[model samples]
Target chain A: MADLILLFFLLVCAVTAVAQRELLNSAIILSIYSLIMAVVWVRLGAVDVAITEASVGAGISTVLFIAVLTRVKRREEITRFRVQVLPLIVVLAVGAALIYGTLDMPDFGSAAAVSNTHVVPRYLEKGVEETGTDNYVAAILASYRGYDTLGETTVIFTAGLCVVLLIRSEKKRRL
Target chain B: MMDFILAKYNFWIYVIIMMIGFYAVIAKSNLIKKIIGLNIFQTSVFLLFISIGKVEGGTVPIYQGVEAVYINPLPHVLILTAIVVGVSITAVAFALVVNIYREYGTIEENAILEMSKTDD
Candidate 1:
């Protein structure tokens, strides 16, 4: 019951943030959105995901957003906040397609879910034995999925390197 | 009818939130606003994946050497990487936005368009 109400409030915060007049205000609301989203993940039995969301979504992202917001103009243009119809229609169509597609999916928390049946049991049974880690998610991430995590780390490194390059170039030009 | 709504309402709510983000990304004029929309859209997908990973009487996927159901661990691992990637992408995006503002002097879509037209 509480989870349902939280989801509803999440939707409201998300929409309100989108409609905010100031980019800074939107960023703040989005930070709140991320925080609530973390709680939602906890309710869904994903503690690791909840931690990641709280740190990445609510903490670091908000700081980065505000730092950038300070560098740019604070307020969004009011003259251009017009109701756009064609995009709304397009978004609605895509959403309808998604909803129709979900009718066939397994119900939430079904033990017989296909995802729960295959490959999952193997990981569950052998995960600790293979990786010497109690947390299967961590074991998979660090051992079974080592290459994927490395690639993601490299991607983050590349992104940071690119940002540094861009900022340095801008500064040199200014100098 | 109530049971149907209860059973399927999560999917519908996520879709609606996803659409709101989509609409903002397409319709908003401000670059920063678009970034926020992109974040919302990205996280909605995350929530959808998390919802799928739930189990009827499951605990978190920390093995305890005892009998218990555990939620799927794959999605959680995948989403952790994705969240990091999303942040890096946002960082690069904001850097680009800053450079765009320096080059063009405005982040509003229409203003940037007009500036480029004047440049041409």
Candidate 2:
């Protein structure tokens, strides 16, 4: 019942955020959407992901969006709200195809689902013994998948470098 | 019919959200709106993966006495990294958008395109 309500709000937020004409309002709505998403993650049994979503999705992303909005126009140019037939058709077609694809997915939250039967068992069974961490998500992230995390860090570093290179004022260079 | 809907509603909702994002990306003229759409699209995919890892009756993937049924930890770990990466990508995208505004004096796609065409 709670999941149902949260999911419904999720849909509402997604639609409302997209429909907003003001970029700042849209960004704020997106932040609220992220907060709802974090709660949904908690209900889905992912505490670590919920925390990250709360911080990064709702917090940092919103801040960055607003910062950019300050430097650019906040109001999207007023255009006639005519139905964009081509994009609408394309979106509908893709959505229908994806819905058809989900027909074969295991019933939601089923323990016997394929995702649970794979290497998950080993992870759940031996994770603590092997990694000496109470949090299996942390253990897997830091120990089993440390290299991936390192790569992800490098990606973030490259992004920061790109931002500095792209936006820093030329006056700063001379100074 | 009810069983079908009950079993698959989450997936359906995700598809709807994904389509909403897709629509914004392709239809919206503002570059920032397109980036917002991209964020929504990325987050929906993350939701799908996290949903796949859920167990009907399970606790968070942390050690809690040997008897606890923990949901899959792998997906959480993967998504943890992904969320950070997604934010980084958003930052880069915003930087590009800021640069575009700097050069063209407008962020709307149509305006920028028209300006560029007149430049040529």
* Candidate of highest lDDT: 2
lDDT of 2 by residue, A10-116 (tens): 98999889889989999999999999999999999899999999999999999999999999999989566776999999999999999999999999888999889
Put down candidate 2 lDDT per residue, B1-120, tens digits, no spaces.
Answer: 998898889899899889999999999999998999999999999989998998878988889988898898899999999999999999999989988887888999998899989999
Instruction: Summarize candidate 1's per-residue lDDT along A1-175 as a digit string, tens digits.
Output: 9999899889989999999987888998999999999999999888999999999899999999999988888888866556988998899899999999989988878879897898888999999888888999999899988999999999999999999999998999898
Instruction: Give DockQ: model 2.
Output: 0.89
What is the TM-score of each predicted model, taking all chains together?
0.97, 0.97
Q: DockQ scores for all the models shown?
A: 0.85, 0.89
Q: What ranges in model 1 sit over 4 Å off? A: none
- Model 2 lDDT, residue B23, Cα: 97
True contacts kept of each: 0.85, 0.94
| lDDT (Cα, tens digit) per residue for candidate 1, span B12-65 | 888988998999899998999899989999998998888888887899999977
For model 1 the local lDDT of residue B44 reads 87
